[model samples]
Target chain A: MTTTTTEQTPVRGGSFEERRRRVEAAAYRIRHSALNMGEVQGQGYVGQALGAADMFAAVYADQLTYRPEDPHWEGRDRFLLSTGHYAIGHYAALAEAGIIPEAELETYGSDDSRLPMSGMSTYTPGMEISGGSLGHGLTIAVGMALGLRHRNSASRVINFLSDGELDEGSTWEAAMGAHHHQLGNLTALVDINALQADGRTDSVLRTEPVADKWAACGWHVQRVEGNDVGALLSAFDAVAAEAGLEGRPAVILCDTRIGRGVPLLETREKAHFMRIEEHEWQICREQLTNGYEGEGK
Target chain B: MTAAPTTPRLKTSAMIASFADPGQKTTPAPFGHALVKAARENENIVGLTADLGKYTDMHVFAQAFPERFFQMGMAEQLLFGAAAGMAETGLVPFASTYSVFAARRAYDFLCLDIAEPNLNVNIVGGLPGLTTGYGPSHQATEDMAIFRGMPNLTIVDPCDSVDIEQAVPQLAASDGPTYLRLLRGNVPTVLDEYDYSFELGKAKVLRGGADVVFVSSGLMTMRALDAAKELARHSVDVAVVHTPTIKPFDAATVLGEVDTDRLVITLENHTEVGGLFETVASAVVRAGLGKRIVPIALPDAFLDAGALPTLHERYGLSTARIVARTLAELG
Candidate 1:
């Protein structure tokens, strides 16, 4: 029964091109919602939201197995967000998936809003863990994976972390543990945007040779263009193919651009924790829609 | 070849052995054994450790249920983070590590992952306070203070094997996150003689006295009880109140045990600040009882590493020091 249910997951309707378009469409909506949320707060970690929207799109729209109506279903796949500041993007994806109302995006960072600026599992639906203090999501994912394996359930654990998180020794600890425990059901999605709170990720702390590091720690590693839905879909497919084998947890290192899809914000010098001018909000929205539609042609 | 042994290689492990009194009966690995018993009934109970299974006595649980045990390497943060994850998956995880690691090293993970979400993860912190002889790095002298402010986290400082054997099932049965100051490895048994049973948020008065009341928790309760018996020879009638649950503190039970006549003394295996002493004092001050309390706790300083007995005596935690303090306070 578990095998049948697990196999019946991934409800992406249509062919490969059709699936890519569908993911692109979802990613566009996520980016739009994130901008709306940022407008409500006047500022946020919007650069990260804009950058990581595609990765969130691929997971929530295609790869992840969850019941949108029932966020707390025990048998559902777990998506843990370690980079809590990315809630702008996550709330967008949750709204896109219908787990939360789309109109609620306006209340993203307000008082009494379940959708806080930082992702808190207690407040937000479908958020498995509170992820503001970076480098925690992967460790929890390893635990959820181990627990699911103990229960003999087929649920997968998808942990979304950032490149800057690699600086944390605990992330490496969980990285080794995932392979040590042979949790094939666990997959890590690393958004390598090369920018952090201080400055460039490399300038702050050289986590170069990122892919090699994950491979050295005994993970089934893959690197892809994060903004490209086709590349992400293929990497996720490759990850799924290794499920029946001895546990080798997979990590897809996605290279993303901070302030992606919005060319005006993309060229900004300080994209980490961006504070856009009030008037540019509409321009940012127009660029996103134009850039997304331009990609199809 | 290495140089010959300098200083006669110290006699026995007595200096660093378990907190057992001379000829006092003890039960070995009480925490691990009791957890194994709890897991026997509840399949959702799983054991996890950060490469300190044997040291923390979680190895016993690991042995009983190998499939259920998770070795989280030497990462305290991951050990707790994973425990929270497992708890989110509807399984209760008994994660063990040193008190230093749980309180000092992995404070964020324990706070955000387990406490913030309030998962049912029983954090068994070994070597609380002066139990270990490895000085400040290993001893969690202010563990209670470090965790007292974290909302939704229940703290339990068990006195002996009996308290542990009873508290295990209760901590597991409780719905929220809980931290247990673990007493492992031939733990002394004292509460058994008093016919005491453990409850989550309640304090039990073991013995009644007229002149002095000793308010204590954790292994210090054993020392307080022994001191009471010794003080009796000097005509000092004493009362020992064991408030094991540190948070959701049984303030009413503790308040009822106090009065205007008897002198109150707060005893605990923690630093003078942010522990039972502070809790009792806070309760008294808020209630406007105007009662004074003589705190019998480790000094607010980095402690020296040596024999457990020597450290306990030096820190006023040994029975002799407790007796001396009580006698001096009486005069």
Candidate 2:
């Protein structure tokens, strides 16, 4: 594994304001990368990629301890993408984190590209597991956590799951297992976009009182606006601090929009798998940039 | 509305009691004991079970290495998925469950999560090939067939306690995914008497003869050896070739022993399809030996729940049945 120098340093010792600014910048770049990758494919799970960009930024840019170049580093914290279709967001984050070259973003979802439409561990670097199948990442995370504990490794495991995956029984089984083993080093980040491939997540299978369900399963629960970089950073810090010491796993229920930054795409119906017109590509990018500039002002 | 009369459901406990009583005897510790020994030597070795710790003999590992043992409840998918995760973190995880669950319930997990990446996860499957009297649900008669097509997986069907003890350390030392058929709790001892040592993909000739040869695996090898002795009384000599490693099958050894004049029989506790029978027959056909090859294996159907002796006799897996089949084939 080649070791690449990280462009951004850890947020430790920085002021809360400074850390929030850095995280917001990282999230901004991640969203930009997602838009660029989406333009390459024209139609994909671009909505999911855009919505979860902030969460991915929080994990890769702020919380995760990893070498951008050396993804197979034994001591690095693992981030598993359970919802494999969210690879667009993860690829964006990877590019921003220097794990993958930002220039390679154009090759996403293309033939002979390392960045496939779905996240496959065999195809891409920094991908911990191949996960298109829902409800498998959390269980794998539980196992990784147990193994790390047995080896006395301080590495943490963070699994990214979607709201639609909550319907799988294996997810709950892993939830019970995480608590049963007292794996404090494990954390689950749920992207509750309220949409799935079938239809609305709730309509497909209601998973309301989500925070309560996790809490009942003995997890340290935190519900926050996933698009808010500051809230995501705080939630991660709290969970990281309590992990291993609390003897309980952690979960953050992130309520996020399907398409977050671009105003034109945010309210689009059936945005689960967005297909923008060829001419609308430049317009989407303009909306994203304009929105980011307005937020900054 | 009139209430319909419902048929009484058969009680599982009553069904269990009707099976022949497994007589109490001194049974040696099987895979779990060997695993404990290996775990003591290697800190990275861990044990996991899907609510079958006691039944699968993983309780022994749990007691020995309390901190390293993981009980994943009854979820077979989680059991295998977690084992793959453990393997990712540089741990040699021996994940055990009933063969039926591992092959049928959690096969996708094993295929994608474990076997796809070729992780160092040892999946120990208990109740292989009619070891249990609980009917088709527990009997893994077709497990070998289910896992045969999977790539990067080494399948092992140990003959007895001695073979299992030897295979455990080898499995730990091996770096890829493996599926081991397990015989738990007071497992029968057979290979030790023949001074047998397990080599990963090699077949050992337990006994050599000229008239007929039995290519066998699992406890069926022990039955073949017993049948060979019975054949000796009828002035017929039989050779026994034990092929414990099923996937990377030792075809050379099997073909080396084959002759056009002698009858070659492939016997296994599993179904004939995609098991030892298919493996040996395919190799023989490829070699164009033109030898008469006979397959004496279990039927590719759900077996009836009964005593071990009765099930063995019905399926032609018993020593007596094997001897009779060999004689009938010879005549």
Candidate 3:
């Protein structure tokens, strides 16, 4: 696959066409990085990583503003990964953000590398919270948002969660607390690929009417095709504008596909986790290069 | 059918006023007072309780920082999990619940979310061991054994109000996670003889003796001190070593005092099987210090409900039992 420097895009909130192109390019970068991460690990949650590539790309590339050199900057927006096993996605995103060397992606899950299968906050730069136990990010994000608002800072907090991670009751408690405090500066992007390890999330524990759940809890809700770079960019911009308006929090439901770009893996029922062999790896690389139209969700 | 005893008279001295001003008519005021002071100094500090603010004396923090305090409402697991979240966001969260719940109900979350991740969460657990007379249900008799096995968790068994007040900021400023056993509601005002400086993972020698070392922690340390004073009447030389930090056990301090000639008796208000007795015994054995060790702790049985003083005596956690144990072990 080639690394293309697409023309800089801005949305009409700045430049729509330019923003879409840059977002597509970012998706391509995250997908390639995730592939490299999975290859080094021999097996991983590559399917979910690939699925959430667009949302991750949209955030690191366009939404969040920060200096790669200063990850601990007080003013930088905080990004928390609640589904820790999906750290391969974050590894890809961090590489794109230049917090970690893009080449370090190949050392993922290696004996001596900093990248582990599960995310560790101290081990990884750009990880504001070390998340492994599910259902913890929203509460932490609430605290950071509260602190930031207290200090009169304009920085926002974005928490990335999996549909499956919502099974943790503590997550809902945090969601309730977030709305109760009217933390408008906090936005939670649920990468609703509808799959979790061991089986489909719905079959195991259905979290359907998910948007209504957030709305009923007092969050200003939005839904979008997560893989559509344009939609994701619009969703983020809309949420940012709505934040702190009458003190209502925001929840963007990103309806996404598992194993998004890879045709065979995208339809696989067990794509919650992937154990791709070397031959499968070649097929994935070829399919990504082909640049087929976005597949089924 | 008997009526519960009316409120006991407030029988404490002037030095204890710093600890008993929280309307509880007790010396446990310093625990909440210290937390309130720490919160005032550190704006990022927050307090949480599982319907235990009044019992743990964390109400002082609630009163001082009403917006920052979270009332978790009887859920111990949620209390720790939320505090872990608060800590992740760079907020110093001091969570208070009963020791039984913090050690038992929330053990997995405490070990995984807070300790394993090494978050700077301070868990202040009240009604530890035999401090209350509410029977086995309220007694946190085995908390030490339960928490000692968790990795990266610091365990503190404060002896009195002074130790608690001094240890609050010390634990909060230090990095990583800690579980502090609380002696709330009229905690004995002992340990005044010493300067009350508490170092993490360090044990202090309150009084030295040549015949026996009464190794203990928490409220039992006060009881042992009282026993030591009484033993002096019989000319029985008994030393007292107070180990506040249960985890990261001070092996050097423990071994420094252990000898074949002198007996080592561990006194605690906790269970004999898994609390201070087992901890000190394992440390002594692992360090190859084969002193005659006698454990002076509650017997392996569930205690029935009664008055606090009656229960302490029944469980053999009273000062008389400590003195008797030390004398018997010396023989």
Candidate 4:
């Protein structure tokens, strides 16, 4: 029970264009780190990491209040990755935030590395729970949010879940629970990439009317293009502005591409668990760098 | 059967009755009352239940501290996950639900979210080992077996109201995750008559005899005492050993009461496969006692729904059955 509160600089202070440039730069760095980590495995959930890079950048770079030196700070906002296999993206964000050394990105999936194949709270700093089993992170986040509210702490709980997670019954259970509790401090960040292990998310399980489903569960819903740093930042700001006021939890449905920065990997078939060929790695990096340059960052 | 009554009979089919008791002593509010007392001293103690507050006696806590009580609706997974999260923020949460739900439905959440981190979450499970007549669905006969293999979980099956009253504060004071078999509502009071107190992992020997030694837990200890009285008339001396904590079992205390010369009978309200029988058997084998042990427990099958008295008798868990089995073994 250390009651240490980390001071959070208000994310809404800077000009819109300035914030966008900074966020785009951070997202670019996160994508680079994720690509480096993927190169270590040669075969990993690299598509998801790349796809979720912007969302991660928005939170860690601007919105989340945290101490990079102290991941266990009591006042820090919790980011729970329900889809554990997306650890590459989270690790990149952590590295970008200076929570972990950028040098550690090279050891992502290596033996004895803190960055495991999946997100494990015990193994990695800033990871809230061990999430490989889908649909568990939201429930845990609900618990954490409720706990923080009971303590009268100002900390927030943001849970990251995939579209495939919407198929799990427990996810709905947690969704309803968060609303019933009126967890204003909780927000669900759903990555609706429309791709899963089997095939398309809609083909496997139709989660099309996803925004309506979250609203029906009593959550304040916001849908946005996940890879667009401007849209992502605005959605986060809106959610944070609603904190501690509305008696409803908020959910941001992020419609993202599997591989956003690199065009080569974006259109690749069966990109759920991707295996980028050795020569393709350098080309993907070059494309990502060129895209960042085109963004005028 | 006969022709149905034409006058719209009230369908009481879903209503199941508890085992009828002739004695019908005033059941004590040990668990709830003790929790209230503990919560008064420690503000971090919160109560949670998955729509079983009244059934599990959590309503008492809810009434006493409404702000601290969280009704997690009918979701067991959220019940446990929320409890874990509360523990993460340094709040000790006692989450209660039926044993079947905690052990069967939300087991994975309990394993990874609670036990893996070894959070200070106290899970109180009701309707353990045929305490209800709601059939196998409600009966948590295999709860012990399910939780035994989970790392960092401390399991306790308290015998009576007194043990529960004492065990609550002790569990709240301890730091890791614990699974306690809850005897809720009007919990029977038997341990107080023997001046028994609960120690976390220690087994207490209530009575010593020369002919047979009975190692028991939960309500079976009461039956063992009753059977001891009946066996005394036939010139049979019996010893009763009460083991409240099933995991971190007090094997030393159990084996000490075992006179290699006397018949050792392990009794429980759980299945014959993995409860006290297995724990005591392993202890005996490890000690090389070569003692012939008999396990008097429920059959390894889904139990049928019936009155508690009939179910006990039919399943060989009654006082009469215990006496008969002991006498047969002695002869």
Determine which window of 10 residues in candidate 3 chain A has minimal summed lDDT.
A1-10
lDDT winner among the candidates?
1
Candidate 3 lDDT over residue span A1-297, tens digit each: 011123211222248767777777778889988887788777988998989999998888877766677777666777888788878989998888878889888888888778888887768888776777787777667666766665567778888998887787767777777787678888999999887776888898998889889888889899999999889988877876776676878988999998988887886666666778877887887788676335321
The complex in candidate 1 yields a DockQ of 0.82
Docking category for candidate 2?
Answer: medium
- Using Cα atoms with residue i matched to residue i, what is each candidate's TM-score against the true structure? 0.96, 0.93, 0.88, 0.94
Model 3 chain B: lowest-lDDT 10 consecutive positions: B12-21
TM-score of 1: 0.96
> For chain B alone, what TM-score does every candidate structure achieve against the true structure?
0.95, 0.92, 0.90, 0.94
Report the C-alpha lDDT of model 2 over A1-297, residue by residue, as the tens digit: 112234323333377777777777887888888888888888788888889988998887677888776789887888999999999999988888788899998999999999999899999999999999888999899999998888778888999999999999989999999999998989999999999888998789899989999999999999999999889989988886775589899999999998888888897886578888889888888998888888873
The residue-by-residue lDDT of candidate 1 on A56-98, one tens digit each, is 9999888777777788877777888999989999999998887
Q: Which sequence of candidate numbers ranks them by TM-score, best first?
A: 1, 4, 2, 3
Q: What tens-digit string does per-residue lDDT give for candidate 4 at B2-38? A: 8987775322123233332567453655678888989
lDDT of 2 at B308: 71
* Highest DockQ scorer: 1
Over B1-331, each residue of candidate 3 has an lDDT whose tens digit, in order, gives 4786587533322211222223422364778889988887888788888887987888988998898887766656567766776776678889998888898887867876788779999999887887666667777888887888888888999988888888899889989999999876666677777655778889988888877788888878877888888999989877889998888889789778875477778887778887788887887788777666788887788876666655666677777766776676666
Ranking by DockQ: 1, 2, 4, 3
Q: What is the C-alpha lDDT profile of model 2 across B225-250, one tens digit per residue?
A: 88999999999999999999998989
Error in Å for residue A255 of model 4: 0.5
What is the C-alpha local distance difference test score of candidate 4?
0.87
Residue B235 in candidate 2, Cα distance off native in Å: 2.0
Better by DockQ, candidate 3 or 1: 1
